[model samples]
Target: MRHIILFFIWLGIGQISYAQEVRYETVENISYVDETASAYAKEQCKLDIHYPTSGENNPVVIWFHGGGLTGGKKEIPDFLKEKGLVVVGVGYRFSPNVKVEDIIHDAAKATSFVMKNARKYRGDVDNIFISGHSAGGYLALMITLNKTYLEAEGLDADELAGIIPFSAQTITHFTARKEQGIDEKQPTIDELAPLFWVRKDAPPIILFTGDRELELLGRYEENAYLKRMLSIVGHEKHKLVEFQGYDHGMVYPGLPILVKEINRLVKEKE
Candidate 1:
């Protein structure tokens, strides 16, 4: 009887281990744009996908990297890997070489591609979340808030699971202003600004930023104003988080919070 009880315990341990095991795969450099797109568009509009192969209907997180809209490559954050989620790292054209509007269109195209091809990678189209740091965060907010961008791609921005931008610009991106010969210190809010598109009916969003005093010029203040405006517009599902000691480069600490929020949102959907 002792030997039999020991065998049963070993069997239970094996079953538990098997239940906890998950396999993941990474696919790199797939173009999101169509064949008719320009050469530069095809080159810059690629994305890398990292997804779990063992799970069905897993959530997807599309991440954009920060480079102030001038430079940055697609990269899957190591913290997001192997967590029973599909992560897409997007690449888009830079400013000056391409108009900022065109860069935003690239983000929409990538999102539409992911939404359309999600099931092929075992991802849940309904659980597709968008996020990024700084300039990438700005792109995430622009495409999510401004319906025209996603609408042009045959998608409704409201269909997204959520938006979680880290230290994103709430006003017109400085790069867009730079293209117009405006200095970075000057603040502007227009069609290119995320603050210009706030609505009560949009998807849930959680804006994360560093300390107000330690952040880049007006970064925290802009996000705070965006939160206030969202509340004034009667948007119920928006939130803002400030990390005390971190500055503009707060992606590392903010990523875990992003993962938590993603999980919370996913559970809410279930």
Candidate 2:
């Protein structure tokens, strides 16, 4: 009976360790992604890596939060924790600390860091998905269309597995144009805008937006136009889903659908 007791104790330990499957890695004070920042004093950023313990080559998602790029933590929504996938919630410097362009640069660097080290976590380097809410969605779209940022990190944007945004602005983000003294009412889509990056070769894009009438600031219409433009460019792997009853503020309640879409998109790519 003593041997039996010890066996059960060992089994319990194994179960406990298994339950801690979502491993985490943090990069504190990430002032810069370049070698120079390693020796400079600057604000830090971190990544909370969550993963399922049982998959051989799991898909990884980098989720950017939305607080108008002024505030928001590097957080994975609680619902995201048990999805049987890998999730990395990002934190970047806000608007006043840096220009809107700098925020895009930070996102690119964070993605590069993850791709460069993907093997360490049993994640597929090719299956990285960029996703976010509101301002975060706008950031995700910019990264997908304006490939320069990822190119700086030596990764091609076309090589990304998918582009998914929840209620992301498709027109010029007001915050960015505001930085240039441009009027938000007279918004323009320039090279910095995601709509400007539409091409036939873009990764499979699955866009989700809230109901048109209930959305904030013409969010649904912008996505509709973006979808049309991508279609005009002959992008066949694109989809736009309008959640019938959901509104701009429903991303928390709407992410599972995004996750399912992620699953579908990756499977198609595979």
Candidate 3:
């Protein structure tokens, strides 16, 4: 009974330490693109960064909002707030107005900005993570898997801490293929596809998908195949998770898993 009381006391102390408030601030509407970019891109290519005011080297996660690459404002998700890490919410131009390739270029540029400015926000550049839902996830995979994109942005792709995509498409994004006169039902894996860039040496990837029965047709299967291919190519770290009852809109259920993986990988890096 005495030992049990002491254990409870330790638990209470741990909780108190964990709950200690960590003050944070937001820097909003910073343009990630330059004057050479199109007027629409200059207007739309912005980001909002939220980071803890204290801590010299907190881990940072650059989050891309999901709007199918056509629409969505920059936002720092409430789920990630005050979690002792920096979160950069990125914004980029959309399709039909701009090609999907342009949107990906914007993503790479935003990541480069985050890396260059991480120190200003007390973030650790070596521990940067990329994550997003749906189309945002697709961009994360593209920038991390295809080195040339980040190379063009003057960032090393291999320096990324990890990639945690929530319900991303591994095939050529349907919207992109649609622009090319291909039916969404007829899937194709080409140069635009994340599957096209899978390599054994790419950064760790944790893929989350919603229920196969309810998700966008073949979404889970597509990520599963990517995971299988990553393994076949001898990639050492990768995961595929499916939420049994959720559909394509499963970001909320998947956020905790993302956080857990962030912690795990951050520790490994340390």
lDDT of each: 0.94, 0.80, 0.92
Off by over 4 Å in 3: 1-21
lDDT of 2 by residue, 1-270 (tens): 999999999999999998786654433333335556532113445566776556657888888888887888777777777676678787777877778888888888888877777667667888888888988888888888888889988989887889888899788788888887898777688866788887888888888888888998788988999999999989988888888888898786678887888789778776
- Give the clash count for each candidate: 0, 2, 0
Error of 3 at 144 (Å): 1.0
Q: Mark the 10 consecutive residues where model 2 has the least summed lDDT.
A: 37-46
Q: Report the C-alpha lDDT of model 1 over 100-173, residue by residue, as the tens digit.
A: 99999999999999999999999999999999999989999999999999999999999999999999999999
Leading candidate by lDDT: 1
For candidate 2, the lDDT comes to 0.80
Who is ahead in lDDT, 1 or 3? Answer: 1
- Report per-prediction Cα RMSD to one decimal: 2.2, 4.6, 3.1
Give Cα distance to truth, residue 111, candidate 2, Å. Answer: 0.8
Tell me the lDDT of candidate 1: 0.94
Top candidate by TM-score = 1
Stronger candidate by lDDT (2 vs 3): 3
TM-score of each: 0.94, 0.85, 0.92
